[model samples]
Target: MNESYKIISSSILFWFSQKKWFVYSILISIFLLNLNTPLGLTVPAYHSLIILLLVFMLVTFEPIPFPAIALLTLVLQVVLGVAPPNVVASSFMNDAVLFVMGSLMFAIAIVHQGLDIRLAKLIIKIFGKSKRMFLAGLMTISAVLSSFLGEHTVIAIMLPIGLSVIKNIDTQQADGKNAVLLTLFSIAYGTIIGSIGTPSGGARNVIMINYLQEFSNVSIDYWKWMKHAYPILMIQLVVAYFVLQFTFPSSLNNIKMRGFKKNVVKIDVKKNINHLFSCLIIIGIVSSWFAFNDIYGLGIIALAGALTFMIFGMISWEEINKNTNWGVILLFAATISLGFQINETGASSWLVLKFNELLATFPSNSMDVSWSIMAVLSGLTANFFTSSATVSLIGPLAIELHPTDISFALSSAIASGFSFLTVISSPTAMIIYSTGLVSTKIFFKVGILMFCISIIILYLMSQFYWVML
Candidate 1:
């Protein structure tokens, strides 16, 4: 018996050293802590935050897999007794999560039709034989396409094209491969820049919007989202371009471009005109969302436009299905449910109370102090949790701390989007890590630098663009 105990203790210690072990530990801890506590809706909310942090910590920074983290979360949630089977089960069916699924299907349609490739070729033709012009065109196209279709779809549709462009580098140069890497940076950064501009741009943005409306009362519709997001996106893109260009100048030396040898196929006339119709659909959806619905509920309009797309045969079910990432959807659902448990158990409230008490020692202006802490902590927390879960858990608390400075809270929320210390910080970090292009240390070095720059820029942007002068 003593030997068995020794072996089990060693195994538990070993598990913590591994990635998913700590995650499961936290999940179980939350459940056990809340099992007897009088937590309300907040119980699940706490679980959400804790679980998200663990999952991202593993996915981006550790070699542990995403699906495995998710499975561990599920099992721990069950064994710890934080929630009943039905409540845990229902998290999988959120409307916001479903919309994401539907959008994916729509995105796949565009890819399936060979429309994305044809469009890239058109872009290649437009840049007028200049490599710089061609790179700019790719960024522009990626941004526009990602805003409606979602970032993953945009990345999937365009990544190969970017690589192909790299392959096409003129053979006359000895280091043609280096030339492509520079252009690829443009593609990667531009895709990241565009991803924040719209709901469909990324999963977390949509999830954040839904949580904003559902939990808080801040309603930013499609048009309103564009109002603030477009400005940030444009600046971010230009900055990203200059940063990459300066940071990796060797990546762009002129070369004899190669490989786009296939004859350019013009999109059929019917689909050519379909672009105009798609434009109308986009415009109408934005206008209608603003004109109709309460501030907290504009998603129905996105759903409506999606329906229009389907009914009109602009994109088919198969296309949408192909684009959706059910794994991500499931992950979001599970985390949100956990967040609910956190809230209900009063764990979040208790944590906030303790934090606020600690903040009483700071002599600075409460608003400034609160926002500054939020900006930093949100980023740190996100290394362990997702941005959406970060927002869901901390956003409301930030607002509560400084209700008059709602913009400050918003700044913190946006700042939380920067998570870079660990690979699990954000979706982009996670997805890109999956591609195996760079090492963990490479990710850490670049990610930390970007995180620092983002903090400064995010603070300045919040002040200049959205907050007080």
Candidate 2:
């Protein structure tokens, strides 16, 4: 009896240890729900805020599967009278969610096309001349490709090339280790910096665009978004090169350029017409996004691209189904659904009013101050949480903060791309972390500097450059 009792107690303790955050989230949510609704806020709005708190804790801790968190979000909205069943269901799936699904499918298809081999050869010919040149090249190429192909996809392609370059290097010495770390960080940071350049760059961008259109009735087409964000991307590429150069100083002076080329496989696109054909399909999809996105929606255009890839037999359905992250899609849809309700129930507006009260305490209540705060908050939140979730949950509050000034919405969206602070902040960061070369301590150390620089650059661009356009 004593032995059995000890075993039962140990099992209970083990379960509690693993599930403590889950219990805390529910307990705190229940405690908040019991409080009286604040002044100037409806009961439904108050309840929605409680749900948001619950979501933040659950996502940050991830005590349960993301799909579970997502399902709970949907169920809670209906259960707490935050919105009706139909309303909740309507918000659960929208163009933004479709875009996320299609983008994931498209990424898997693009990876299957073997363009990375061709890209490797091209990168070697162009940028493999020297160590500094190679680092700059990786960042520039990654930024340019990621701006259109999405950071996750571009990283998937670029990481292999970066790894190949550093694979043969001896890491026992300081400089060799620096070379390996620099190459990887360049690819990761470049992918992140470029993810804000266009609407297709990241799901967070699309999420913000959806919020802007839905709440403010403002429409920003693909080219228009590029025009606004591309300049900042360009500046970041240059600044990031210098920042990374300073942070990870390496001299591959002894290493020959031939060594870099020998590491990557030689594959010419001309030898394979299918590779060229795949490129044409991608171009057609991008062209459609630029010309017809307003009519068809970005989500539909993205799906069309994935379908086109399928029709041509570039990638199999089985491949896409296996590679696509369904749980992430469900989580995005659920968060978006909650964001919609937050806006619909007046929670975002009420939060904005409270923000305004705080702003009033400041001496200068300029749009600049408000914009800066929003951008910083977005960046900080995004570092801890997923970028898409950050925008999905915060986009409404940003739009409600300054409905007339689109800069608030734009800056917040762009700032969320500063996913440099943590390993799990973005897929690109996680990709590099998986390599086992860059440690978590280095991530935090280098990330602090880059994050600061990015915020400063964003502020300058928003103040001067964004206004001219």
Candidate 3:
């Protein structure tokens, strides 16, 4: 009887330890809900604001799974009378959510076709002789692929190749650690910087696009987005190259490694047919996105591409289903829904008024100051939370501040892609961290430098290049 009592007590303790934060969140939310606002906002708006804070905390700490946090947000919205059940359900799914889902599916299809080996060989062939050139090649390749394919997909493909290169490095050499750091970060920072180049580059871009279209009636098509964002990508790539060189300078002038075997494309039978078909599908999807995205939308085109892959037997539903993180989709959908609630309930406007009063202390209300503040806030917040979540929180406020100038909103979204401070900042960072060779201290040290450089570059672009565009 005594032993049974101990087991029950331990189980209760374990549950309490695990769920303590959740309980605290609930209590705090209740307290916030009961308080009368000095800001003179509506009760529902205040509730939505409190819910947003709860979500940000839960998502950052991840005391619970992200999807659970999303679902809890939805439940609380209805439970607290912030929104009715029907309104909450309607906001949960939208074009942005669909785009995220389709993009993940398309990314999985591309990754499953064993294309990374071919890409790796091509990279080595182009820049294998010189160490600096090879690092440049990796960054360029990762950036370009990520611009079109998606950051997570490109990083997932490039990470193994990077690890292999690191493993093959002669650790007995003096510059071994530098070589490893350079190689891994080239892939990581490249994947990160590339994510802002186009809408397909990252889900956050799509979310921002969706927000602009929904809230501001501003539609930025694929090529137009590229026209605006690609220059930033190119300039940042150059900056990233220099930053990596400065941070992790390899003593060796050249690296001659022999493991990169050439993959010759043979036009022989079923294999050739599959490769050709896959290439055509990818090209077609990308072309359609660039040409007709405003007409048919990116989500449908991406889904069509994934469907074509499955229909052609290049990939399978079982494989795609297994690899896809449905939780992320749910989290994105929920956050988006919550963002709309914030906007609909006037919470975003309320927050913006408060922010404007703070900004009034500054000497200027010029566009430059506005742009810089939004960019810095979005960029810094993204280093701690997911970039998409940052966009969801800040995008509405940005739109509220600059209702006519879409550039401010676009800049904030693009700048949020600069996630260089921590492994948790972005999926690409997390993938690189999984290799177990990178030091957290080293990651932060170099990341802080890159982060500062990127912000300065982005601010300059906004002042100069973006102005011309």
Which candidate ranks first by lDDT, i.e. highest?
2
How much is 225 displaced in model 2, in angstroms?
A: 0.9
Candidate 3 lDDT by residue in tens digits, 1-469? 9999999999999987988887787788778777787475888888889999899878877779878998998998898678999999998988778888888999899888766666777788898877678879999999998998888889888876777666667755658778888888999989999999999898888888988898889989998789889988998899889988888778643344344442334436776577677778889998998998888888888889889999988898999999988998899888898898899999898988887888778887556676788888898899899798889777888888887777788888888899888888888988888777786787889888887877787778777777786
lDDT of 3 at 334: 87
**Model 2: per-residue Cα lDDT over 155-175, one tens digit each:** 999887787767777888888
Model 3 clashing residue pairs (backbone): none
Which pairs clash in the backbone of model 2? Answer: none
Please report, in order, the local distance difference test score of every candidate based on alpha carbons: 0.61, 0.88, 0.84
Tens digits of per-residue lDDT for model 1 on 60-118? 45445555655666765666566777767775456566555555554554455455555
- Model 1 scores a C-alpha lDDT of 0.61
**TM-score, each model?**
0.75, 0.96, 0.95
Candidate No. with top TM-score: 2
What C-alpha lDDT does candidate 3 achieve relative to the native structure? 0.84
Better of 1 and 2 by lDDT: 2
Q: In candidate 1, how many Å is residue 272 off? A: 5.3
Q: Which segments of model 1 are wrong by more than 4 Å?
A: 1-95, 168-178, 251-323, 380-386, 392-396, 403-405, 419-444
